[model samples]
Target: MSLVSYTKALNRALGDALAADEAVCVFGEDVGAGLAGMTLGLQSRFGAQRVVDTPLSEQAFTSVGIGAALAGRRPVIELQIPSLLYLVFEQLANQAHKFSLMTGGQARVSLTVVVPGSGSRAGWAGQHSDQPYSLFAHVGIKTVVPATPSDAYGLLTSAIADDDPVVLFAPAAALGVREDVTAPLGPVPLGSARIRRPGRDVTVVAVGHLVHDALWAAQELAGEVDVEVLDPRTLYPFDFPALARSLRRTGRLVVLDDANRSCGFAAEVLASAVEAVPLLAPPRRVTRPDGTVLPFALDLDRALQPGRDQLLDAIRSVMA
Candidate 1:
């Protein structure tokens, strides 16, 4: 079994997708230079026609991608930074995400938008480090945040293959994660939750990079508190059934999210959990303060993002 890093897995996924489907193509700024690591060597392998590097205009290229998708091409748009998504929010939320429904399900925008380094990336400051998956999920777009190397590979494949538009965020913190690949990698269905650690005391639902923090907390609290860590790979079409089953067994819940606390993905998960199942105690979530803008200072940047200590505290609170 060979060890595959998260970034490498993403690169492999794009390569495989390009090789497997003639309709699949990519558009982004500096993608041909492989700045994000996922598109490394893709241009030479797939040729410039398939891996076309567009001008530095997110909105323009995003619109072009939508047009290409409508014209029967599967376009994967790679955003160097997550916050650039704000620039093309109208294109994604209003236009591309609506075409399928606007055309009475006759039209589909098979477009995949991949954000390689989402969330705080060591003083990228406010402009570059925003994890806005919740916003996309709220707008009814398929949102994916894979937590591991294998999930990164599988979920990206599925997102590209999906007929509807999908936004996959590869959290910056998770980029370093590497796993031993014993079996062949393939598509992991969207909206599925993976139980990283099974326990009976409480279920800790962690999103994106926070999944790793939850797992670490679970390991540290072993024997004292059985914390079941669940990674909601896709936030929009969430695996509510899996959460309900976990909550039934644990009777308690804790959510670790990297985005803002108010009306974030964690809030949605907590809201849905309470309505769907009976809980032994009130659920809790650990997230950045409302409308958090990460500071440029290294320490402050790290402080703003949710970490293992916060997750551990939340888990203990639920267990109490």
Candidate 2:
């Protein structure tokens, strides 16, 4: 088996999509130079037109992508940072995302916005470290967060192929993750959750990079607590049935999320799961503090983000 890193898998997915569809094109600030790593070497292979680099303007370029999508082009916008989502929120939420619903499915905007390194990147404090996938999910837009290398490949392929506006976030922490591959990578459905580890004690639903933290906490507490790890590959159009099935086996729940505590992804998961399934104890969620703005100091940054320790505490609380 060959080892494939998460970024490489994403690159492969983008390459495959471009090769398969003549209409597929990419727009971003430094995509041609491939500064984000996921678009590395793509420009040289796909030609300048297919992998066009844009001026340093998220609003202008994202608007261009929206227009291109409306005109029958499958444009993938590669965002260098996650916070750029805020800059283009009006364009994404009001313009691109609304086309289909506003026209009653008559319009199709096959646009894919990919944030290669989302969430906290050590020193990339405040503006750069936000994990806002939950915001897109809240607004009824398709939102995906793949945890592993293979899932990264599959989910991204599916996102690019989707006939609507889809936002895919590759957590900063998960980028370095590598996996052993024995089979070909392909598309994973937009709204499916994967059971990373199965157990009977409690179900710990993790989003994006926090999946690794959940797995680690589960292993660390293996003897005392039988923790189950569920990765919600897609946040919006969430696979509630999968979560329901897991909750059937384990009567407790805990969500490990990287976003802020109030109205965050973790909050949504906890609220939805409690109503759908019966649980043994009160559900708990471990997340960044509400209104948390990550500090530039490495220690402070680590402190602000959810970690395995917090996950373990939440899991144990749910089991108790």
Best-fitting candidate, scored by lDDT: 1
TM-score of 2: 0.99
Which lDDT tens digits does candidate 2 get at residues 1-320?
A: 89999999999999999999989999998898888888989999999999999999999999999999999999999998999999999999998999999899888999999999999997998999999988999999999999999999999999988999999999989999999999999899999889999999999999988888888888899899998999999999999999999999999999988999999988888888888888899999999999999999999999998888778777777776
Q: Once superposed on the true structure, which residue ranges of model 1 sit more than 4 Å away at CA? A: none
lDDT of each residue in 87-118, candidate 1, tens digit only = 99999999999999999988899999999999
**Reference-based TM-score of each model:** 0.99, 0.99
What lDDT is reached at residue 213 by model 1?
83
Residue pairs with colliding backbones in model 1 are none
- Clash totals for all candidate models: 0, 0
C-alpha RMSD (angstroms) for model 1:
0.8
Please give the distance, in angstroms, between residue 96's alpha carbon in candidate 1 and its true position after superposition.
0.5
How well does candidate 2 score on lDDT at residue 319? 70
**Global local distance difference test of model 1:** 0.93
Worst 10 residues of 2 by lDDT: 311-320
